[model samples]
Target: MASMLKDLWNRFAGGGNASVHEEPAAEAVEYKGFRIRPAPYSAKGGFQTAGVIEKDFESGMKEYRFVRAETHPSKDEAATFSVTKGKQIIDEQGDRVFR
Candidate 1:
């Protein structure tokens, strides 16, 4: 009875297999004068995102931007799956840029 009570207490106190799972960090990729890194398990459904990263060469300080690459299923062709919506950031001149 004592062992069972202890086990119950441990479970309620978040001590029995309630540890947090840490995901692996993603490597940064450079493109168009900006670096992009994937945020680990931060999306709505445990998916990673391509985050814009900025680094200062002199101080080696890093910054993370909120803009991310996202894919959405086509509403019109949900069954046929003809097209997918993609997220993008554009500049005033209609050029793709990292936010």
Candidate 2:
């Protein structure tokens, strides 16, 4: 029971299954002067939809990360969805997304 408790603790604490293989993040795509990188991660039942948006400024750089409620059975689909959602966000908010 001790080993089982330890395993449960690790899983809930985000340190379990270090040997499990993780999918590589999708390639970053450029859109309207912004860079979008899909970075979906494995979650229960499916891959979670998430990504990062970045822009370069004269002074430095800005970045924003987003996670959506959507989930997909395949990592590729999740990544594609992440990019699509990122494009929508960029189109809707532009640089305001940073704030």
Candidate 3:
């Protein structure tokens, strides 16, 4: 009964179920040696990436690199680019780049 009224109200409001279809959010993709994780959709109707970098100077000392897809137009592209860059950095810096 409640659903019927809701459906009737939707039809009257011009927001009938016929015109309502929710699109599934984009899933993260992994490419090359990088992992691309999808984030929640933004108000602008697209997802935005979040980048984080961590470094520890205590004990064994460690540095972590976390680059998100914010700079790239797509998540897969970002992951590939980031991984390539990371590989270059590691190759150049060696063990100093991490713990």
Candidate 4:
């Protein structure tokens, strides 16, 4: 009887375990109208990028425009660029715009 009770207790205690751990949700940062993924690297050896948001200037209507920059590590020194004009991509140069 004691052995049966111990077996029952162990079975209940270790019954079909599910996931032990779960992955954390991704972290994001927003700047202006862009949603930057993860966190921006430090300026020590990081590159900066820019994005623009506009409405439908292409079809002569209203729409949403979203642009993002490339991610750079904290060791490479290079320029990044992104451009958008009214839900349409324009030109990008060194993470800045030229008039």
Candidate 5:
């Protein structure tokens, strides 16, 4: 299957431990009844804008992760942009983003 091939490729390319570690996540920011955690990862000679937005629903906790094309020279700048983007997404889409 395609998944099997992808797994094989990952093992060969990533030494089979790609999922074991990750860049430490930034502290969560509470905003508009949601939690946004910036997680900038180094990429393409810079830090890439990334983050996770979460909310507690009656059903359960829901989360959405975003990675923008924007990159910054420093992790702090990337994280700042990530939070801003997360806020924009929440303001524009709200809970419908989890849909």
Candidate 6:
């Protein structure tokens, strides 16, 4: 019947009770002195790293460096070194200063 056909069409074509969702993925964070890039293939299966950190101590002087912090294979970690000018360097915490 017409009703039966319409029901079948609605079931297949209509967005009814289907679950719309997505898996959470890692995020990137940028700072004044550095930019963090996602590197999911590192020792950790899902982790991000600082692609480049530009530091200009004196005028017309530039330097680039890479930094990594200790973290679980799945969770995000802080940078091993300071990524910005205002950020503090705490030694008591797990934070490190990589030169």
lDDT of 1 by residue, 1-99 (tens): 898566445533436542112222444554444444433323333332323344455656555433223422332222111111112221221122322
RMSD in angstroms, all models?
13.4, 6.3, 15.5, 19.2, 5.7, 18.4
Please give each candidate's TM-score.
0.33, 0.76, 0.35, 0.19, 0.76, 0.25
lDDT of 1: 0.33
* lDDT per residue as tens, model 4, 11-41: 3343322110111112322334433222122
User: Per-residue lDDT for 1-99 in model 6, tens only?
Assistant: 897455434433433331111111233344444333332213334332333323345464343333334333442342322232113322221223334
Residue pairs clashing, model 1: none
The worst-scoring run of ten residues by lDDT in candidate 3 lies at 17-26
Candidate 5 regions off by >4 Å? 1-24
Model 2, span 2-66: residue lDDT tens: 98567535533447552112333777899999988887777667877778888998978898877
Local distance difference test, per candidate?
0.33, 0.77, 0.39, 0.29, 0.77, 0.32
Is 3 or 5 the stronger prediction by lDDT?
5
TM-score of 4: 0.19
Counting clashing residue pairs in each candidate, in order, gives 0, 0, 0, 0, 0, 0
> Residue 31 of candidate 1: its Cα lDDT?
45
Question: How well does candidate 6 match the true structure in TM-score terms?
Answer: 0.25
Order of the predicted models by lDDT, top scorer first: 2, 5, 3, 1, 6, 4
Indicate the residue-level lDDT of 29 in model 5.
Answer: 93
lDDT of 5 by residue, 1-99 (tens): 898567535533434543112453578899999999887766658876777888998999998867677889998998889899999999999999998
lDDT tens per residue, model 3, 1-99:
898567535533437432112121234333333333322222123333332122334464353333232445564454445445555554566556554
